[model samples]
Structures are given as C-alpha cells and as structure tokens.
Target: MIDSSAFQGKKAIYYTLGCKLNFSETSTFGKMLADMGVVTAEKGERADICLINTCSVTEVADHKCRQAIHKMAREHPGAFIIVTGCYAQLETEKVSKIAGVDLVLGSNEKADLIQYLNDAFIHRAEGTTLHAFHAVKTKDIKRFQPSCSKGNRTRYFLKVQDGCNYFCTYCTIPYARGLSRSPSIASLVAQAEEAAAEGGKEIVLTGVNIGDFGTTTHERFIDLVKALDGVEGIKRFRISSLEPDLIDDELIEYCAGSRAFMPHFHIPLQSGSDMVLKLMHRRYDSALFARKIALIKRLMPDAFIGVDVMVGSRGERPEFFEACYRFLDGLPVTQLHVFPYSERPGTSALTIPYVVDEKEKKLRSKRLLAMSEEKTHAFYEQYIGTERPVLFEKAHRGKAMHGFTDNYIRVELPPSLARDAYDNEIMSIRLGGFNHDGTALKAELT
Candidate 1:
C-alpha cells in the first residue's frame, strides 16, 4: 500500500518525444501528479520522479529516445524513472535493461500511471528495487484514454482518437499503438467544453488516425466536427492530418463555412507515384490525393494545405521519384513535410527486392525539401498586403512574440510591440514581407 503522505510536495520533471499526442499525454500525466501535490521541478534541478514519453516512428527516433533516457538518468540521479510511449511499447525488454529505468509502461498501461507510481514508491521505501514492466499486446489494446491538454504554446491538443486500423507496409504504428479506437462523441465534447472554460482559444484535433474516429462509438468524424463547432469560447479549431480517401465532400464543405474551424488542412501524400503507393499498401492512389487537393483549393482558395511526403521507400525506382516530383510540382500545397524513409524490423517492406541507396535517398529528400521551401515562400508572398486575424502567443527570450493566422501563416511582431498584454489575444494585423530572420512574416496593426 502507498503512503498517501509520501507524494505531497515532491518535485517531478517530464521529457516528451514524438507527436502532439504524446505531448498531450505527458501534460495529462503532469496534471495527475500535480493533483497528488507533486510540483514540476525547475530547470537543472534533480527531482523525486522523472517521466519520459518516447516515440519510435523511425529508427532515428528510436536512437533519440535512448539518448534522452540516458541524459535524464544522469541529470536526475536517484530519482525514480518511468519510461512509456510507442518506443517502450514495442521494445519493452530493451527499455527495461536501460540502467536507470525503474519501470516500463505500454501505450494502454500508461493511462494508469498514478497507481504504478504509488507502487514504485512503496517498493523504494522498503529498500527494494522496482524495475517492473506492464504492456498489453497490440491486438488487445482496446481502452481509449482521452487527453486534452495545452503544450508550451497557446493552442490546446485534444486527442479525439487513438490507434490505426490500416497497417501500411512500412509502418509499425499499428503494432505499437494498436487498432482504431475512440471515446464517445459526448465525452470529447465535454473535454472541449472544459478547455473553453479554462480560457483556451484554439484546439487542434489529434490522433493516430483521427479521420477514422467513431470506431468504438457509432459516431462519425463529421458529426464530431459539428458538435465541436457548437462549442463556445474557442476562437479557433484546426484539423490535423487526414487520410486522402477520408476527406469527403461533406467535411470539406462544412469547414469552408464553419464558425470556428480554420482554413488549414494537413494531408499525407506518402508518395506521388501510384506504383510506389501501391507497394506501401496505401489505400488511396495519387490521383485521389490530387483530387482532394484540388477540391480544397476550389472551396477555400486561400487555405493553407500541408502535405507529408516520404522519399526513398523500397522499390521507388528513379523514374518513380521523377514522377512524384512532377506530381507535387503541379499541386497548390503551401508546404511539404519531407522525410527519408527508414526501414523497421518485422515490417513487410523488407521482403521487397529493390532498395534505394543512402546517397540517392538523401538526394531525393533534399530535392523535395527545396521544392517545399519554394512553395511555402510563394504561398506567404501571396498574402503580403492582406489583413488576417492572428492569435499571438507569449514572447520568447523577452524578444519577439509570434503567432499564426487563421490560415496557419507564422507572423512575428517587432520586439517593441511584443508585449505580454498581447499574449493569447487575437487581433487583426496586416501581413508584410519576411521578418529579419525570414522565419516568419512581419506584421503591423490593421
């Protein structure tokens, strides 16, 4: 049994890696600890507990997780360490052997972290080591733990769904996160209401496969959108990544005229070559993706569209890559998130005979990245003289305050006007040319 008094006044530090979903989960965990009277540790201070949320989207990500764990262990000596997230779910044994790790929790098990921490503290007080592991098999991961929390930024992330049913050939997400699952629509709306009550102005819907929401409940994604649109006090809402085939006409039409939904969309076009997409076992083809982009442009011309493109997967011949580049060049997307493919163990991708060399993969990624910059710059230039509603965030380094427009353009105000008074406040501002650093567009009061 845990001593209830043991948790009071304890200091804890959290380190999170990977997607916005992980950040939301970490935030929720922080609240849980806070309720027990544990406070966040200050920078460079040793804490009584250390929690690390990890990601394993790629081999490089796995290496980073390992490095972060080692660094945390060294910095907070004698603190009870807990590791969880996708990396821990897939590599329980490997994470368990890490020198300072006291416990390993899987995707599902992470929801019950408070109880595990209590047990760990009990064992520690008795002069016993508590290196425990708890993980549910992928197929058996059914519980959906809802999370709605703010990051260091102004916008809050609401996890509307979790897990994925479509296991792409080169992906390990389904293995690490489990099948599609989500809580009821009423539950999600309640969470959104709570966020609004807390003075949140923006909320971004996050999930492993959000468009595939309503797997557990009989609700549809469009229905959920309509319900959230009725939420008051939230000035903005942005839909994260959606599958191409799932961006139905109804959803697109609704967002174009919705009260709070912003004019921004992130759709993954893993590859522009239909042949390569087929090898990856992606449900939709390149033509379908192109049509979706065209429809979005037709409905909301000024909307910012972001595309995720992975280069150099197995069997992506030179001609296939050339075709992909051409297809992307013809699209009207605002930005391209380019990544070089990384092979993972136990994936069907290894059975494919062809493989792009490292040099070629890097070259391909570089080309796409250059194209992405050009596309984004042109998109930003188009609205140079226009006025848009921008929600400014807190200033950093006491320097400049940055914010995003309704269409997702990053804008910066001069340090002179970047006052604390403007933080989290939405104002009409005339967009100007690039700032001194060229990282964001300069803005002036309208």
Candidate 2:
C-alpha cells in the first residue's frame, strides 16, 4: 500500500537504546532504509523521519526514551516520529500518550515501519498506530537474515538466537521478547561464512539469551561454535553475555581448543548468595557458578573472564554482600560489570519486601566497583611483557590507535601501526607495560 515515490530522498535518523541486540537490529533497519533510497543522517540534524528504538529494562530507560522524543520534536517539529522496541511493546498506553510520538510500532511490526510511513504520507492522516501484540510465532519470526553487507564491520554481530524463555523474578525480557528461537545450523553457518568472506576479523554471536540457544533447534551453543570454527577468514569469534547456569565444561573446552573463538567469556552471576539466587529465580547457585569459573580457569588460564553482578537486590544483607565480595575476590575473573538494583514496572522484585535503602545501594555499588577495579588491574598485570594478537580498530583520541588482545586486554598503539591494520584486522603485538590507569596496555608492533 506504500507509494515509494513520496520518500525517494527523504533523510532518516535512528536512535538505539539498550543492548548489543538492539544495536544490531537498528543497523539492520538502517540498511533497509538505505535500500529504499532514504539517506541516513546524524542525530539532531534535519530529517524527514525519526526512528527511536527504545529499551524498557529499567525505569530510567523509560524516562530517557521520553526525553529523546521531546528533544527530537523540538529540533525538527514536522518530522514524523516512530517509536518501537520493548518499551513501546510493553508500555503502549503510556508511550502513545507522549507528546511527540506520532506512531508506535511493536517489536514484530518494526520491520514494516518504512512501508507504513510511505502509506501514511501518501494518504495524509493525523497519525497511525500499528501495535502487533501477538506472541511472535516461530514461523512468523524470520530467522535472523543478514540484510546488511559484512565488509563494513571489522567485527560483525551475528544474531544466532532471539528471545528468552527464562522468566527471572526481576526481569521482563521473556514477556517483551517472546519465547526462545534460533535459526537452523545451515542458516547460521551461511551467515558466518558471509561475514568471514567480507573480512570480518571477529564475529560476536549475540542474542537475548544466547546460552538458551538451540532450545528450538537440535544443535546446542557448542555445536554452533564448532560449525563456525571451520569458517575461513574470520580470525576470532566472541560470545556475548551468557547465564552462569549454561557455562558448561564442554563449551569452555571447545573454546580452548578452537583457534577461531577468542579466549573470553562474559557470564552473568547476578548475585553471589544462594538465598538471593533463589529469590531471583536464577538457575545456578554460587557453588555451580564458582565451579564454572574454575573450569574456564583450568582450561584457559589466561582467558579474560567477565562477571555481571547486581548490587542491592531484595533480601541482600551485609553478610550477603560480604559473601559476594569474598567470592569475587577469590575468583579469576578479569572484570566485573556492577549494576545498582533499580525497580522496573511489572517485575515481581518491584513489589518485594526488604528493599535496600537508596543510600545503602549507592554505598554497596561503590564498594563493588572498587573491588572490580582491583580485579581488573590484577588481570591486566598478567599479560605484561607478553606478545599477543590484537585486532586494531580505528584511531581515536588523537594519534593513538586502540585494539583488544587475544586475552581481551585493551592495547594502545602509536599511529604508525594504524595504517597496516585496518579496523578489525588481527595482528601480533608485544605488550610493553600497563598504563597508570591499569585499564589498558601500552604495546608496539612486533
């Protein structure tokens, strides 16, 4: 029903909120618009259409979404505003009432936004709302087809999986993203091969619950990695955030043996206390989480291990906090992503008793963050005076170039090294010493 002629050269701007998955989806949407002859422009610049991909993981995300819509409306009043993603899907009534939100599309209907816009402009209506709330049926949800070209990225995000099956007590992803689904092994391999052929040095396999991958397919996460290992041109592959319960010995061992996969694992621990884990409805206890970390250490001793922890959750006492600190202090983790607990609407944790005081939450967050710094510095110290493979990215912050070593240490190279290695090209570099901040390593081309 869309008359494509009306939008031939209209400029479009997109803003993304939330995780890597959201970014990947936004990039895919951008490519679609480009194919339709829509020019992509910088945010805050004049454009005919403004697309805001929103996140509703927390109340703060909701506030930011409203702020973005208002700001964009003020900058370009006549531009059509389209709101989509988890926040729009879950809080349709509230989002629709926002002053500048001209159209609201749910997750499934997001792909059809351009066509809807074309139709709306041709017909000249006040506005339109296409809220497709039906749970994305397995067939209705297209297997993540790579719509964009791969040569653009030194590292490409291949969405091998989608949706979450686990309904964590403090999470709403299950309701917002629907059930777990993944493409067939053949489809995933084809996509990875395309990225490899396009000169992508690393392919980060991302998803809502990547560990929950293969629930729909007979193939498991390890199986997918093994399949990708055979793909040529891709120097490395990385797994995004995964649940502690799914970090098995087999996957760790496979990563250890594989040349293509990087020696890094990002697992979310959420909480260290067994009581808190139970309250959060997490699948693994502290013991199991500890064992998983141990297995990764045993297989790949120098592997960069990242942990995700939430501070100030319901029923977390001082003893519980100390338990978390002690566990992390003794672990071989490279870094920690600490988050202060924030209430989200429709989540059970929001209504739970024993909420920590706001001041106490800030105190606990600071303590954990300090511990995280200590752990990160210790991890980076291990790679000093060693030669490791680094995938150099574009130069930034003056003449310095930055990249990540195989062990996931951030390395800074002088501008000279920047020319030989294109963005995402893997090369060997010898680490000189740690910077004063302890966050990165100073390195020279070997």
Please, what are the lDDT tens digits per residue for candidate 2 over residues 1-446? 66667777989888889987887777777777777788886645798888888888877898898888888778877787888778887877678778777787766677676776776675554454333222243235443433323323456888888778788889877766667888877788898887777667788888889988888877888888899899888788889888888877888888999978888989999888888888888898999998989888898888899999999988788888888888888888888898888787778876568888889989988988898888888788777888998888876545777789887899987665567445667778888787656668998777
What is the lDDT of every predicted structure here? 0.92, 0.79
What shift in Å separates residue 246 of candidate 1 from its native position after superposition?
0.9
CA deviation > 4 Å runs, candidate 2: 42-44, 125-153, 396-398
Stretches of candidate 1 exceeding 4 Å from the true structure? 1-3
Tens-digit lDDT string for candidate 1 (1-446):
54557799899999999988999889989988888889999987889899999999999999999998999899999988999999999999899999999999998899888889998888878999899888989999887888898856788999999999998999999999999999988998999999999989999999989999998887899999999999999989999889998899999999999999999999999999999999999999988898889899999999999999999999999999999999999999999999899999989999999999999999999999999999999999999999999999998765988999999999999888788878889999999999986779999887
TM-score of 2: 0.92
**Winning candidate number (lDDT):** 1
